[model samples]
Target: MSELIGRLIQPRQPAFWFMVVLNALSMVLAWLAQKPELTLTVSLLIAAFALGNAALGAFFAWQLIRRPAK
Candidate 1:
């Protein structure tokens, strides 16, 4: 486990913008799935995932923007 951890490195490119766009899209899809014909359980699950992804995206974006690029 220590060896594996030591080998891991943060990517130089933050890719925060990409994540933000993807998560935003996911949230939109999840919202759309809440139509009358959709299953309530499935819609809720999707919404939850969407919310999580969006939060992660926002966090990454904030971190990326906070630092000055080398």
Candidate 2:
């Protein structure tokens, strides 16, 4: 478990930072999804945030895939 955690953070680069943001955003989205009484405005905001993250995540993913293997 510790090995996995260490490997996850060892890079200290843009991908790592984006990963951290993505994780936090996912948790927030999950928690929000479980709520039954959210206002429409709040829901819309979350949806927008998610969409923005999706674009950013896709760009980074493309960059990662394009990177030459070690």
Candidate 3:
């Protein structure tokens, strides 16, 4: 788990960008799902996931940009 996170924090060119975009899109979808038939627990779960993904995306983006030019 530590290794996976360490890897995530390190840029991987196209793959890293793709992961960022994917997480962004997923977060958007989760945010959008907070409506209608879902119960409070379900909605909260979705929101939690959205927030988590958002944090992850921010972290990865920061790390990617923070990386020194190669």
Candidate-wise lDDT, in order: 0.64, 0.63, 0.68
Error of 3 at 65 (Å): 1.4
| Worst window of 10 by summed lDDT in candidate 3 | 3-12
| TM-score per candidate, chains pooled | 0.59, 0.60, 0.60
Q: What's model 1's overall lDDT?
A: 0.64
Best by TM-score: 3
For model 3, how does the per-residue alpha-carbon lDDT over 37-68 read when each residue is reduced to its tens digit? 88888888778877777777776666655554
Residue-level lDDT for 69 in candidate 1: 53
Per-residue CA lDDT of model 2 for 1-70, tens digit only, reads 6544454453545776785577578567756755669887887777777766767765655554455433
TM-score (C-alpha, index-matched) for candidate 2: 0.60
Cα displacement (Å) at residue 52, model 3: 0.4
* Clash pairs (backbone) in predicted model 1: none
Where is model 2 poorest over a 10-residue stretch in terms of lDDT? 3-12
- Residue lDDT tens for model 1, 1-70: 5433222222565465566576777778777768778788877877777777777776666665555454
